[model samples]
Target: MKVIRARSAGFCWGVERAIEIAREYATQGKRPVFTDGPLIHNSQMMERLEAEGIREVGDYLSQTSLEFGLTDAEKQRAVMVVRAHGISPERRGYLKQLGMKFRDATCPDVGSIAGRIKLHARKGYTTVIFGDPKHPEVIGLMGYTEGRGHVISTEKDIDFLPPLEDKICMVSQSTMFTFDFERLAQYLRQRYPGALVFNTICGATRERQSDVLVLAKQGAEAIVVIGGRHSANTVKLAALVEKQKLPCYHVETAAELDLEQLGQYKVIGVTAGASTPGFLIDEACEKLAST
Candidate 1:
């Protein structure tokens, strides 16, 4: 079998930065360190961090308290690390009110989108987010718009939007499908002629998606996508490959690969999500090569 791996597979700059920051904190041996959420979507990486004495806290106040598991006195000595997905401004303020210290690990690309929304919202514009409303990144971006933000997963959702006389500013989740975002942006502009649109999807995501499209077009018999099940970007990659009419398996680790299924393919392509570690990608590639 011929095994081909996507060059763009594995960690992007932002996830790498967040992991580096967390590791640095872990080595300091100072106060206990906790992330606002799993630093990234990969469960294996989260487990590795936990083994290194780093922990994750849930988003809700009650969940945070439970996950923290520290007394008031102990809590005062803890340092919280904001995840790469970032948190809402309101949540940041609430953390400050609790006298908690946190280090922001928000991706610069995600930060820029939030900044743009806040700037436009201050000028009385409504923010339209082309993303899943429940996504952590979108949740954080919405905070910048006060109460004037709306989320739409598809172009159809735009029809359900309340009529807005105010100017509109649109941005996308950093990991959204590039083509879908453009289509949605076009629809919004047709309806609101003066609406401002920003292509906030990260370059890494675009390149990864493009790479997979190319592989599928090249007639790879099957494609293997590696990442956590909860990873939205990984799910999108798998869906994109399937849309191309090629067999695709979305697996978290090499162990999940089906030897019998993969054996049927003479040439297979491999790719991974942004949050995936390089080692996991290598392992998957090696497994495919062996088969």
Candidate 2:
């Protein structure tokens, strides 16, 4: 089978920078490096970081109390890195109170979204975030909205919103589909003509989404999306493939590929989430080419 790999099938700049920050601390050895959550959504990469002495200390969402049996000396030598997905202000404060050095590895793109929300909220605008409310980035952005923030994922979500007398400002989670965000933004404007909509999806995300179409144009019969199951961006890539009317096989690793089923395709297109590492993408492409 012929294999075509996407131009943007690996870690975005933010994830790479976050890993670099943690690894730098891990290598120093003077302090134990820890993250509030999985630094990125890739489980395999997290395992590798674990081997490098970067430990995860908090829950996946960065919620709940963290329990560690550390002495004062240990706490003094510990460093806590915020995940690339970022954390709410409350979570940030809680993590800081743990008595470790706090470093924020939030993607600058996410920070910009938070800044926009914070600015609008201070000006008496009710912020509406188009994202999964449970997503750490969205949860974090919500913290900047003062007390007037609403999370919406669909038109119905917008419909169910209460009548807003305050001015409205809208933004999106960094990983969402561009078209979906635009569609909803239009709907939001129809409902609230004065609403301000900002498309905050990162450039890397747009590149990855565009490459899926590039693969189709290259005559791929099926598309393979490689990333962790819990990776929101990776899941969206697979869904986008299906939206393009192509067969999409979403797998975390090459081992999960159904060779028998995949063999039916003469040419396969491969893409991965922003959180996916290059090694995994290479392995998947190699395995498919071998078949």
Candidate 3:
């Protein structure tokens, strides 16, 4: 089978920056660098980072309180990093009380969204976020809404909301589909005239989304999406492939690929999420191409 790789497949600038921040502390400071959650969504990369003395300290969602016991000396030597997905202001407060060196590795794009939300919330705007309610990024952004945040993933979610006489602001999680966000924005505007809307999906996410179409146009019979199962952006890529009426094989590693099933396709396309490492993408592509 012929293999076509996406130009914008792996590690986005934000994820790369977050990793670099953690690595610098771990390597240069020679201290254990701990993150509130998985620094990035990819488990393979996290495993590699663990080997380098970077450890995960909190739960996957960044909701639960950190339970590990650290001595005063350990706390003084350790550095706690906020993950790329970010965390709520309340969570931030709790983490800071741990008395460790604190570093925020939140993506700048997410930071921008949080800043906008904080600004409008101070002015008493009801914030409507279009994203998975459980997502760490959405949860973190909600903290900026000052108790006026509502998360909606569907049109029905919007219909169910109570009347809002106050000003309304709408924004999306950084990895949402542009079309879905715009459609919801239009829907929101119809109900709340003069509602403020911001398309805060990062440019890298848009580029990756657009590249899936490019793969389809390049005559790929099927596409392979490589990333962690919990990775929102990677799942979206698989869904996007299915939307194009092509077979999508979503796998964490090349070993997960069903070679017999995939062998039926003459041309296959490959793409990875922002959190995916280049090594994983290369392995998947090489496995598919060699077969």
RMSD of each: 1.9, 1.3, 1.5
Candidate 2: regions farther than 4 A off: 60-64
* Pairs of residues at least 3 apart in sequence or in different chains that clash in candidate 1: none
Candidate 2 per-residue lDDT over residues 99-183, each given as its tens digit = 8888899988888888899899989999999999888888889999998999999999999999996499999999999999999
What is the full ranking by TM-score, best candidate first? 2, 3, 1
lDDT at position 3, candidate 1: 86
- Worst 10 contiguous positions by lDDT, candidate 1: 60-69
Judged by lDDT, which candidate is best? 3
Candidate 2 lDDT score relative to the true structure = 0.91
Error of 2 at 184 (Å): 0.9
| Per-residue lDDT of candidate 1, residues 184-208 (tens digit) | 9999999999999999999989999
Q: What is the lDDT of residue 171 in candidate 2?
A: 95
Q: In angstroms, give how far residue 129 of model 1 lies from its true place.
A: 0.2
RMSD of 1: 1.9
Please give, for residues 1-291, the per-residue lDDT of candidate 3 as tens digits.
899999999999999999999999999549999998888898999999999999987644545567468789988999999988888899898889889999999999999999999999999899999999989899899999999999999999999989896499999999999999999999988888889999999999999999999999999999999999999999999899999999899999999999999999999999999999999999999999988
- TM values, all candidates: 0.94, 0.97, 0.96
Candidate 3 has an lDDT of 0.92
- In model 1, how large is the Cα lDDT of residue 126? 96
For model 3, the stretches where C-alpha displacement exceeds 4 angstroms are 59-67
